[model samples]
Target chain A: MSKVSDFFAEFVRRNGATISVYLFTAVIFWIAVLIVLPQLYMLDFSFRFNLPPSKIGTEEDVHTLKNYKYLLFGAEGNPNAFNWLHLEVFFRTIWAAVLVTILNLVICYPVAYYMTQVISGGKARIFILCLILPFWINEILRAFAFRILFGLNGPINFALVHLGIVPEPVEFIKADIALYTGLAYAYMLLMIFPLYNAIESLDHNQIDAARDLGSPWWRIHWRVVIPHAKPGIASGCTMVFMLTAGALAAPQILGGPSSLWFTQVIYQWFYTGGNWPQGAAYAFVLLTACIVFVLTMMRIFRVSLGEIAK
Target chain B: MSADVELDHLTIRFGNFVALQDANLRIPAGSFFSFLGPSGCGKTTILRAISGFLDPSEGHVRIGGEDMAGIPPNNRPTALIFQNLALFPLMKVWENIAFGLEVRRVPKAQRRERAQELLELIALPNQGEKLVSELSGGQRQRVAIARALAVEPEVLLLDEPLSALDLKLRQHMRTELRAIQQRVGITFIYITHDQGEALIMSDQIAVMSQGVIQQIGSGPEIYENPKTPFVASFVGENNAFTGRVASADANHAAVETHFGALRGRNSAGLKTGDQAILFVRPEILQLGAGTQGNALKSKVLAKEFEGFASHIHLANSQGERHISFSTSQEEALNISPGEEATVHFSPDRAIALPLGELAHE
Candidate 1:
C-alpha cells in the first residue's frame, strides 16, 4: 500500500500544477460547448440568412447577417419565409415585457421593503412562506388558478357588481392587460425575495444613526437605505425583467390572438409553419437582445454581480 | 456646553430579567464623569437611558432640568459615540463629521466650514476629504468624537470607545480625550471597566458591581477609601484577611484570628462577634524588621522581581493568610524561601471592612 501511494504521490508532485490547469480548462471547454454553444448557435441563426437553425446544424457553418435583416424587414412572402407580421409581433412583445417589468418594480419594491422593515419574527416568516407556497404548484396550475379567478362569472366581478364598483362584468382573460396581472403574480416571488434579501441585509444601524442625527425618516430611507439596497433592487429588477421577456405561456393562455408575442410566433414558425431556420434565427436574435440588455443594464447601474458576491 | 445629567431611581428590565434597579446618579455639569464597572453591570444601560435610547420603568432621566421621557434619541441634547466608533465607512471624513449638521438640514457651505473646523480640533485637518476607512484605529476614534461633538450636544456619552485600542494607544487616548473634553467644555460621560482608564481620566467615577453602583467618588477616594469590600478588592490589588470580630467600636475593630488583632480605622459600624475583613494595599504591606502598628512574623514564600518594584509573597507560620509585598528599595534582601521576616503596615494605611452581606466569594 505504501509503495503504491508513494508512486501516485510522486506522479502528482511532478505534474500537479499542469494537471490542475488542464482539469479547469476541460471544465470550461465542456461548459462552452454544452451550455454556451447552443445559445450562441441560436444567435448565429438569427443573423444567418432567412433559414431555420435546424438546417444549419453542422460541424462548421459560417453565419451571416441576412437573417436579422429578414426578421427586421420582411423577406418575400415566400411559402416558408419571414413575413412582416413577425417583426410587429416581436415589437409588441417587447413593449408588453417592458410594461410588465415597470409594473413589477412599482409593486414589488414597497412590499419587499415592508416585509424587511415593518414586520419581523414568526409573523414575517409565515407571511413570506405564504408568498412562496404558491410557487410549489406548477406554473400551468398557478396560471389556471388565475384564469378561474378572473373568469367572467368569477368572484372578482361578482364582488365588484355587488359593491357597484363596476356596472358590468369585464372579460379579463381575453384582454392583454389582464394577462400582465397573471404574469406579475406568477413571477412576484422572484422579484420579492432578492429585493427583500437586499433590503434585509442593509445596515440598520446606519438608518438609526441617520435618524438620530435628525434626518427625517423619508430622507433616511431615500438616502441611506435605498442607496444601500440599490444592488439588490437592480438584481431583482433584472431577474423579473428577464423572466417576463422570456415568457411564452402567459400570452398564449390569457392573451387574445391580437396579443400574440414573439415566443408564440417562434413556436408557430417551427411546429406549424415547418420553418426551423426562421424559428432558430428568431430565437437566436432574442437571446442576443437579452445578453446586450444585461450588459447595458450592468454598465448603467455601475454594478457587477462579481462585486456583490465578494 | 454644560448640562448635568440626573437619573432619579432609574429602573430598567427586559422581559423578566432586571438590568438596572433603582439606579440613581447625578453627573455634575462640565465634569468628565465615568461609569467604571465590569461587563453586564448595567453601566451602558444607564448611558442609553440618559441618551433616550431606553426609558426607565419608574424613574425619569433629566438633562439640564428637562424630563427626557418619551423623547427620541435624535431630539435629546446628548450625543452618543458608539463602542465600535460607527464612523460611516464609505463617507469622507468631512462627511462623517458633518453628519449631524446634515441631518439637521444645515446649508452645505456652513456645514463644511464647521466640519473643517472640527477636523482641525481633532488633529486631522488635512484628512477632511479622505474616506473614513483610510484612517487608523486611533484616528477613527477621534473622528467618532468629532462627529458626536458636531451636533453641539450639551452632553456627550461614550460607551467604551477606547476599549478597542491597544494598551499604549489607550493610555495616550485617555489624556487626549480628557484634554478634548476640557477644551470643548461639554459634559463627557465615559463608560469603561478598565481601572487605569477610570483612575487617570475621569474627574468623577461611579464604580459598579452586579447592576448597582457600589461607590461614586474621585479616583483617589475610590482607591484609598473604598466603602464596600468588593470595591476595595476590585479597585486594586490588596491582601484581605477575613476573621471574626473580637472587639469593635466607632474608632477601631480587632479581629482575633489570623493577622491577629490587626487594629484598623473605625470602619463606620462593626460590632464584636461579627465577621470582619481587613484590606491592605501591597505597597502598604512592608518588610524589614519589627515595627509598630500591625506587625506580622512571616516567611518569604516567593519573590518576583518586576523591574521597578519587587513583589514578595509572604506566608505566616500557620500560613493562615498570604500577603503580597512590593518595595522599590534596591537593598537586595537575598531573602530566600522560608526565611523569616517581619512585615509591618501602619494602622492608618489599613482600611477595615465591616462584616456584612456585601462580601463576595
Candidate 2:
C-alpha cells in the first residue's frame, strides 16, 4: 500500500503544471459550451424548417438553403399562409438602426463634452454618477416610464394642451418615432462615456497653445480637439451601432404594428416558426454584417487591431 | 521701452485668503527679471498674474501702457514656457515649436521653415524630426523654449523651467538662457527658488517671503545688503547673532551678546533698547591675526575641510553659542577642532536687522 501511494504521489507531483493547464482549458471549453455554443446551435435551428436537435453536436439529417433563398428572394406566393420572410424588413431595420445610432452620437457628444471638460473635477464625477444612477434600474422600467409619459392621456399631451401649443392631444406611443426616442434614451450613456473619457484625457495645454497662437475657440475644437477625439467617437459609434442593430425590446414594445423588426422575425423562426436552420442562417448573416462593419472601420482608421489595443 | 512690464498694486486672492497683498512691481523690459523665494511665497502667483493667467483682486497688470485685465494668456502678447515644459509629447520637435504658428493657421511650408530656423537658433537644428519624448532633459527644455519664442511675443514667462535639470546642466543653461534673452531682446520673467540660478541669470532679483517682497535689487545688492532678516538668511546662507542693543547711534550700533560687546556698522534701521540680530556672511570672515578689523577671539569648536572652502566653528568664551566662518582652503589658519583662534571681518560687512524672534511674534 505504501509503494502504491508513493507512486501515485510522484505521478501527481511530476505533471502538476500540465494537469492544471488541462483543467483550466476544460473549464473554459464547457463555459463556452454553456453560453456561446447555444448561440451557434440556436442560429442553426433558426435557419432550418425543422432542424433536428442532434445537429448541435452531430450533423445528422439536418440541412436547408430554403430560408436564405426565401430571405434573399421572397416567399413564393403561398396564398394560404402569411408572407413574413420579406427582404425589405432587413433593409428597414438596418436603416432605422443607422438612424438611431446617429441620433445617439448627436445627442451624447455635447453632453459628454460638457460633463468631461466644462465642469470642475469634483462636480464632474457627481454628474457622471447621476447620469449612471438611473441606469442601475431595469431598462424595461425606464422604457415603460417613457410609455406612460408619452401615452394618449399622458402628461406630455396634457402639458402641450395646457401650454396651448397643440389644439388636441397627440398620439405618440407605439409609433416608429417613439421607438427611435426610446432607443436613444436607452443607449445615450453608452455613447457618451467613452467619448467623455477620451476628451477628458486630452491635454488642456494643446487647446491653450492653439488659441494663444491666434486660433479662435471654435477653430481650436475644429482643428485639434475633434481630431484627437476620433478614436472615442469611432469606438462609441461602434458600440451604439452594434447594440442598436441587435435591439429588439424597444422596437417590440414602443413600435406600432407597422414597425415590426427584423429580430422579431428571427425570434419567431427560432421559437414559433420552428425554422431553426433559416434563423441560424439569418443570425449568421447579421453576425457577418456586424463583423464586416467593424473590420471596415478598422481599415479606414489604418491602425491595426494590435495598435488600437486600448 | 519693452523693458517696463509694470504691475500697479496687483492684489490676488483665492476666495478669502489673499495670495498677494497689494503686490506692486515694475519689471524693466529687455532685461531678465527673476522672482525668488521659498515654495508658496507668492512668487509664482505674481508671475502668473503678470502672464494674465490670474486676475488680480485689485490692480492692473500692464505691459508697456496697455491694461492686461481680461486678455487671456494666449491673447496677451506673452509666451509662458510652463514648469513641466508642456511640450506636446505626441508632436515632433519642430511641430511642438510651430504649434503657436499653427494656431495662427500659418501655411504648413512657412511654419516648418520658421520652426527649423528656431531650432537652429537654439543650436538644435538636427533635432527637428525627433519626438519630444525622445529628447534628453536639456533638449526638451530647449524645444519648449524654441516653441514659445516661435510666436515672437513681447514678453516671455518662464516658471522655474530649469529646476528639473541636473546641477551642471542648470548652470550651463543659465548662460544659454541669458544669452538667448539678450539675443531676442524680449522681456524675460523667470521664477525660481534656487539662488544661484537667479543670481547668475537675473538682471534684477526680487527676494520674497510669506507673500511680501522682502528685498529687490541687482544680484550683488540683494546679496550684500539684505534689509530684512528673512532676506539676509534667504538670499545667501548667513550666521546670525541675536542680542539686545546696548547702545545705538546714526552710523553704528553696539550689541551686548554672549560673545563680548560686538560693534558692527548699522544698516540704517535700528534704535536702542530694541532687540537686534547681526548678520555675517561666512566667506567674509577671515582666519588670520593680520586680517583683524572686527576681531572675534574664541576657541575653535569644530573644523571642516571643503575642497574650495574650510568652515571653522568657534565657541566664544563669553557667549552661549558658537560662530562659524568660512575661508579659502589655500590660506591656512592653523586652527583644529579644539584650539583658540581669532576670526576677523570688517565692521561694514555685518548687516544688522531687528530681532527676528520679536518680529515673528
Candidate 3:
C-alpha cells in the first residue's frame, strides 16, 4: 500500500498536484462509471428478485438465490435437472470462440511472418496499409458487410454457383458460417499486430543459422518462430476468445433463428423477459468463464501476463 | 570431415549494383582461409555465396568437387556462424546444439549424447542445460560453434563471429577459434575485416576492396611483399611517396619526387616516366642513417612517444613531402621535434608500384 502511495506522491510531484489529480480522477471516473460500477450493480442485482416499479407498492423484492438456481438448474428445487438448452448455448459459444481463435492464428501466422520478415521497405508499409484499411470502417458496418457477402444471393454464393461448385445459392446465413466469418474478420488486426511485433523483433540470423544447420522450413517455424511468438499468440488468443464469446452484433445479424447465442439470451432476459436478476446472473457466468479461459490459455502457452503485455 | 571449396568466376549483382564480381577462389581442403577487408568489401557477400544463401549470377560454387548450383542453404554441405552468433535464445544449450540432429530424426538419447559430446568439445560440458541467454558472450559463441558442428558439414563458414566480443575476449577467442579449427580439421572459410585476426589465424588470406579481391597469399607474404599499392598501404601502416618514374628497370625503379630522386624496388613493373608510389614500412626505416640506398634527408616535425618506440614525423627539406618512421626509445633520445634528422632504408625494404588507390586512414 505504501509503495502505491509513494508512486502516487512521485507522480504528483512530477506532474504537479492539480494535473495529477485531474488524471487520477479521470481514471477513477472511467473505472467507476464504465467498468467497476456497472459490474458492482450487476453483482448486487444478481442476488435480488427484481420486480417492476408498479408492482412493488409497499415492499421491495428481497434478495434471493432463485435467479441463479433457475439459471443453473431449471426453474426450482429440482436440483437433479439442468438447464441443458442454456448450458449448451453457453458451452457452444465458448467452443466457437476457441475454434475461431485457432483459425485466426493459423491464417494470420503466415501473413504476419511474410509482412514482417519477407516484405521490405515501401512494400511493407503497403502491406500494413492494406491490413488497416478495412478496419477504418466502424466494426458494425464491417459485420453488416460480412452479412451481405455471406447472404443467400451474395458474392460467395454467386461465385460458387457460377463455378458449378454448388448447384444452388447456399443459405450461409442459415448456418454458423456467417457468424464465425464475421467474428474472425472483426478481431484480425488484434491478432496480426501482436504477432507481427513479436516476429519483427526476431533476429533474421537465427533463421539463417537454423536453416544452415539443416533444419527444414517447417521445423524452423515450429522450433524458432512459434516459440518466439508465444506471447503474441497467447495475448491474441485471449483477447479474441473473450471478445468472440461476449460478442453480440455479429451473432445477432448473422446467426440463424435456431442459433441462439448466450449474449442474446442474456439481452432477452433483461429487456424483453423483464428478468434483470437472471440477466445479471448470466452475464456474470460468461465473465467468469472468460476469466477462467484467459488463465488456462496463459498456462497452456507458458506465457506470463507480463510477457503478453510485451 | 573437410572438403575443398572452389568459386568459379562467380559474380553477384543486385540490379545495377555489383556486390561481388568475377570472384574465383580455390580453398584447399582442411585449410583455414579468411577473406579480410573493410565493410562493404564483399567478403560477407562471397561467404554467403559459398554457403549457398545466394546464387552467383554468372558462375558456379563447388564444395568437395560437387556443384552447388540450385542447392539451397539447408541442402548445402556448409554451416555458417552468423556475425551475431545467432544462438537460439529460447532453447537450452543442449537443445540448441542438438537441433540439427533433431531435424534429421535422430533419437532423443543419441541427440543428447551428441550434444553432450559437443559441449565437452567446446569446454562447457556442464552448461548443456542452460538457456543460450544465460551464458556469457564467449560461452554463447562457443555454443554457436558447437551447434553448427553437430551436423558435421564438409565446411564451416564464420562471418566475423568474434566482432561482438570485447577487445580482450576477442584476442583470447582468436587463439581458441584457431585451435578449434585445427581440431575439427574442416575447411574453414572465415571472413573478417580485422587484419590481426586474419594474420594470426588463417593459412591463406584474401584481401578484398569494394567488390574485388586485391591479393591472395599467406599472411606474411601479403604484408611484406604486397603486389599492389592498395595492399601495401592497407594490410599495415606504410609511408607512401607518389611521383613520376625517373628511370625504370625490371628489378628497381627511381622516382623523381618533390625531394629529388628516390630509388626503391619496382615490384609492379614500371616503364620510364610512369606514375608510381613507393611504400616503406615504418619499422624498417633506419634513423641517423649511415647513407644506405634510398636515403631521405629531412627534419623531424614531431614525435609521438609510445612505450617501446617513438614515431618521428619528418618533412623533406623542401617541406613539400612528409615522412614518418618509428625508432626505439633509446635511439630517439637525441631526436626531438623540430630537429634535423637523416633517415635511410634499404631499397629491398621499399616497393614502388604503379600508382593506384591507397588505403584510407
Candidate 4:
C-alpha cells in the first residue's frame, strides 16, 4: 500500500496539478464512457421488466427479475413454458465456440511454430502478411466472401465436383462448414500472434538441449515448448473462445437454417422482439459466462492474471 | 563407459566460407579436452560436428570407433550442455535431470531414483524439488551438467557453459567441472575462449584460429612451447619483437631489430633475412644486468604497482622498442618510473617464429 502511494506521490510530484488533473480526467472519462457506463446501464436494464421506451419514465415501470426468470424458465409459473429451444441454442453456441477454438489451435500451432522457429526473416514476414492481409477487409465482408466461396455453385464445390471428389456440387454453406471455417479464419490473427509471441521468446538452445539429451521431436514440444507457451495459449484460447461465442456477423451471414447462435437470439430480443431488458439480460449472461470461462482457462493453464495481462 | 573421438580430416564449409578445414584430432577416452579460441574461430563449429549437430562437408567423425556419418544428435552417444545452461524453467530440477531417461522409456520410479542419484553427484540432493528458475546461477550450471550426465552418454560436450557466471563463480566452477570429469571418467570435450579455463581444466588443449587448429598439446606444452606465432601471442601474454632474421639454425636464430641482435630458440627454422617475431614472457624477462646473454639497456618509462608485483616499463634510447617485465621481489621496488635499468633474459626463454597473424588482445 505504501509502495502504491509512493508511486502516486512521485507521479504527482513529477507532473504538477494541471497535467495531473488532465490525465486523471482522461482516465475517468475513459472508464466512465467506455467501460463502466455500458456495464452500469446493462446491469440496470437486466433487473427490470420489459418496459417500452414511452413507459420507461412512468410509475408503472419497476425493477424486477422477470427478464432473468423468463430466460431460465420462459414465462413465469407455467411448467410447459420452458424455453428448451433457447437453452439448446445457448449450449450449442458455447460448444461450437469451443470446437472452433480447438480447431484454430490445431491448425494454427504448427503454422505459428513454423513461422517463428523454422522460417527465416523474409519468409516469416511473408507468412505474417498472409495471416493479416485478409483481416484488413471488414469482418462482415470477409464472412460474405466466405459465403460466396462455400455456396452450392461456389469455387470450392465447383472444384470438388469437377475433380470427382464429390459426385455433384456439394452444399457446403447449408452444412455449417462456412460458419465454422469463417469463425476460425476471422479470429486467426488473435490466436496466431499470441502463440507466436510466447514461443518466439523461448531460447532455441532449450530445444537443442532437449534433443541432445535424447528427447524426440514430440516430447520436446510437450515438455518444453508448450509449458513455456502456456500464458500465450491461455490468452489465445480465452480471446478466441469469447469472440467466437459473441460473434454476430459470421453467424448471421454463413449460419445454416438450423444453426441459431445465442447472439442472434439476443439480437432478436433487442431490435426485433422490442425487449431491451431481455436482450440486456441475455447479453449479461453471455458476458458472465465469458468471464467465468476466461478465469477457468487461466486456472487450467496455471497462468496468473498478471501473466494474462501481459 | 566413455569412448574416444576421432576427427579424420574433417572439413566443414558453409557456402564459400570455410568454417573448419581438414582438421584431424584424436581425443582419448576419459580425458578432459578443450577447444580454445576466440569467438568465430571455429571452436564451436568443431564441437557441433563432434556432437552430430553439423554434418562435416567432408571426412568423418568417429565416436567409440563407430562411424557417426548418418547419426542424429539424439541417437549419438554424446550429449551437449549449451552455452546457456538451457534448463527447462517449467520443470522441477529432478524432472529436467530425468528427461533423458524418460525418453528412453524408463519407468517413472526408476527415473526419479536416478535423478536423485545424479542430484547427489552434483551436490544438489535437496534441490531436485525446486524449479530450475528457483536455483542460483551456479546451481543451474550444476543441474545442466547433471542432466547431461543422467543420459550416460559416451562423450560429454560443453559449449562455454561457464561464460555466463561472474568472475568468482566461473573460477569456482572450473574446479568443480574438473572434479566432476575426474569422477565420471568420461571423455569430456569443452569449448572455451578463456585461456585460463582451458589451461586449468583440460588434460589436453587444442588451440584454434581462423577455422584451423593451430596446435594440440597438454597445458604446459601449449603455454611453454607454443608452435605458432598465433599460439604464442594467444595462449598468454608475451613481449613481441618484429624484425628480420639476421641468422638462422635448427636450434637458435638471431633477429636484427631496433633493439639490436636478439637471439632466441627458433623451432620454425627461419632462414637468413626472413621476417620473424620473437616472443618472451614477462616472468622470464628480469630487471638488472644479471644475465650473461640477451640483455638490453633501457630507461624505465613508467611503473605499475599491482600489490604483489610491480610492472617496470622500459624503452630503448632510440624510443623505437619498448618492453615491460613484472617482478614481485622486494629488490625490484627500488627501480622507479623514468629510471635507467638493464633488463635481460636467457636465450632459450624467448622463442622465434616466422611472421604470421598475431592474436588479438
Candidate 4 lDDT score at position B312: 77
After superposing candidate 3, which stretches have Cα over 4 Å from the reference? A54-60, A77-80, B316-322
Query: Ignoring the other chain, what TM-score does chain B have in each prediction?
Result: 0.94, 0.93, 0.96, 0.96
How does residue B333 of candidate 3 score in lDDT?
92
* Segments of candidate 1 deviating more than 4 angstroms: A1-26, A49-64, A75-131, A156-178, A192-204, A254-258, B315-322, B329-333, B338-340, B356-361
Native contacts kept (model 1) = 0.40
Identify the candidate with maximal DockQ: 3
Clashing pairs in 1: A42-A284, A48-A67, A51-A277, A52-A276, A52-A277, A52-A278, A53-A277
Query: lDDT tens digits, residues B1-361, model 4?
Result: 9999999999999999999989999999999999999999999999999888899999999998999999999999999999988888888999999999999999999999999999999999999899998999999999999999999989999999999999999999999999999999999999999999999999999999999999999999999988999999999888888899999888999888667888899888889999999998888988767657677777788888888888877774356335778898586768876678877888888999889899986
**TM-score for each prediction?**
0.86, 0.86, 0.96, 0.96
* Model 1 per-residue lDDT tens digits across residues B47-159: 88887777788898999988898999889898888888777766789988998998888999999999999999999999999998889999999999999999999999999
DockQ of 2: 0.39
Model 1 docking category: acceptable
lDDT of 3 by residue, B210-237 (tens): 8899999999999988988888888988
TM-score of the first chain alone, every candidate? 0.80, 0.80, 0.93, 0.94
lDDT of each: 0.80, 0.79, 0.89, 0.90
TM-score for the second chain in candidate 2?
0.93
In candidate 1, what are the lDDT values of residues A1-310, reduced to their tens digit?
A: 9998797677668779689568668988899988899877666555554434674556445566665666876765555545657767777776777778778878988888888877887878988998888789998887777777788888897999899999988888777656898888778877788788888876666666666666677877777777777777777777777788788777777776567778887888779977666788777777667667866878987888774442
Docking class of 2: acceptable
